[model samples]
Target chain A: MTIVSYIFLIIGAMFFLLGGLGVLRMPDTFNRIQAGTKATTLGAFSIVIGVIFGSVENHLDWIPKLIIIIVFIAISSPIGSSTIAKATYRSKNIPDNLVQDDFKKRGENQ
Target chain B: MKYLITFITLLVVYLFLAGFVIEEVILGSFVSAVLTILLANRLNFKVDWHFPLKLIKFIFVYIPVFIWKLILANIDVARRVLSFKIPLNPGIVKVKTNLKGDLGKLTLANSITLTPGTLSIDVEDDCIYVHTIDVKKSSKDQNQKEISGPFEKILGGIFE
Candidate 1:
């Protein structure tokens, strides 16, 4: 692999590590989701881009797949996070420091 | 005419992504688009193609800014995680959205959810229910309001 590709791979590995750390160390579910979603997306993207560069012969094919993967990640990650957050909130697993719950109020009103 | 346009757009997108032959892409897109249009019509859904062109510029500008904010939030969360004291006060707060349409609501929800330590729980009428992982005692209101900035700009660009 070229120097640039190695750099990208290293960066990607760092991001993935941070994401795992976030999941382990973050206090709450919401924070963990954020760490996992954002870091993994960028980390995976960087690694894939590196792979694309390393495989110059199949660059065209891999590049499109990478784009597709990025798009899919962008569209689905937030939705998945939102779903998990909502479930956690409803299940009362969130920490007690929260103030100003409009969702609960709306539920009460309804 | 709308159906034809939708069909063509879908076909082009399919061909571009799948790298299929023009003929196969055209056939597949036509079939899917026709089915989608019929289903949409039956569901009384309207497709608004008159998207504000001015908002396109805003979208392009907002993307980098949003990504920057995401990175900053990630760092903040990482720091909090590494700290000795677990300073967490998670709560759901409702912020009123100024966005006017379905697209605006979706954009706002997605943006909020993308940020670290926050999640968009629900959207009802003009308000978005967001859950924050860390809610400081004195600055709860300020934090909630600050969270709206990214969504406001991006949704405003897309909807307004």
Candidate 2:
């Protein structure tokens, strides 16, 4: 149990580090936010799953809580990231290298 | 009927989240009922009458695909980050989907967001704006084939 959890923990930490690197390396807020959200969602979820398996199971309580955390994160993360993207676009902080702009048509229609 | 279903669903979720504690369960049950009523319309609460058989298929099939994609997504992102050159050609490209149901579209959106290089920006009816980091020259065809097409293919069987 410890070994499996540790492996997952290491993988999660690696993903988290990658996400941090992505945020630093990406040129714009949009790219940074996307990288951060994607990596962190998976990263944190793996860590939670790892913990669910690793910890001493005196009672079977932690499993459900951890599962709920994963479900909650899965449902909410994309929505949150999309919300941030919407706000960033609305504020007109367009990235210098932004190539296409299809989202504006809907905004204009509104 | 919908309210009852919503209440029960929320109650179950509440219990799961609270981890079977007596005090938490009691308090959460009341809160769940209240919240269920408060957010009923937003929830679009409905149980498909054909749920059982479809759900069995979803569990057996779709889950494996989703899990596979989840693992691949993390690995892909990690690779992108570790690569020496900052490989980015980010753009919000318009892509169209034929998926009709809310659940199918939502699933596709979440899947796209979770997958590497593609982030779902907006879903307007049938059109989705996807922000991708790296764009291949044949990106138009590639994005359709790789990103939205696979999920949409499987989801059609489930949702449609």
Candidate 3:
């Protein structure tokens, strides 16, 4: 169980690193948001699951707290990303090289 | 009905956290009742006889698929980020959804954001504008199918 938890922790750390790197490497705001949000959400989830496994051997009481944390992250992370994406779009900070942009065609931003 | 459901859910969660001690149960009931009375009207989703069935479907069917896709999404991100020459053909494309309910649309948007290579930017009328890391399919219908096919189908069953 400890070994499994350690493996998950390592995986989670690696994903977090990837998320940071992606945010730095991506060309524009939207791409950075996508990379940062997706990678970090999964990274945190993996770490929480790791903690749950690591502690379940000691006591069952910790399960609810950990589960609540997981649920909170799952609910909040996507919403946060969506809200940021909308804000970025509204601000007209979008990239010119977008291969397709239906939002522009719809005249929603202006 | 909504108030009752909210109160019950709150009480259950409190009891789960508090381990059903007598004092905690009484306190939880009081707090849940107060909260339900105050907040029930803000709870948008309707609860009916079908709620339990929908909940079961959400847990048994929807959760597994979401988790699987979440794993795939992380793997996709890992691949994109780790490559020295990152492959990206990014775009914002519109996809129409058949779901009418707000909750259904919200779920679809959130799921799309979390899933592989797609992030939902805006939802307008029956169409969602999605930011795709790779613009594999240019047609709107194909984009709609590729992005939200399974989610829309399952969520339609649950939320609609």
Give the top-scoring candidate (DockQ): 3
Higher-scoring candidate on DockQ, 2 or 3: 3
Task: Judging by lDDT, tell me the better candidate of 1 and 2.
Answer: 2
DockQ of 3: 0.76
Whole-model lDDT for model 1 versus the true structure? Answer: 0.72
lDDT tens per residue, model 3, B1-160: 7777888999989987777579998999999999998898778875678878888999998999998998899899888888888898889888889999887888889899999999998888898989998887646677778989989889988887
**TM-score, each model?**
0.81, 0.85, 0.92
Q: Per-residue CA lDDT of candidate 2, range B36-117, in tens?
A: 8798888664667877878887778777887788778777777777788767787777889988988889988988888767
- Write down the DockQ of candidate 2: 0.70
Model 2 accuracy (lDDT, Cα): 0.81
Shares of reference contacts reproduced by the candidates, in order, are 0.71, 0.75, 0.79
Please give the DockQ score of every candidate, comma-separated: 0.61, 0.70, 0.76
Least accurate 10 contiguous residues by lDDT in model 1 chain A: A56-65
i-RMS, each model, one decimal: 2.2, 1.6, 1.3
Residues B1-160, candidate 1: write the lDDT tens digits.
5565556666666665777666766677767677767754545435566644645654587677777767776676667756787677677777888889787688678878767667788788888888777665576568767778766866676667
The CA lDDT at B14 in model 2 is 81
| Docking quality category of candidate 2 according to DockQ thresholds | medium
Candidate 3 chain B lowest-lDDT run of ten: B136-145
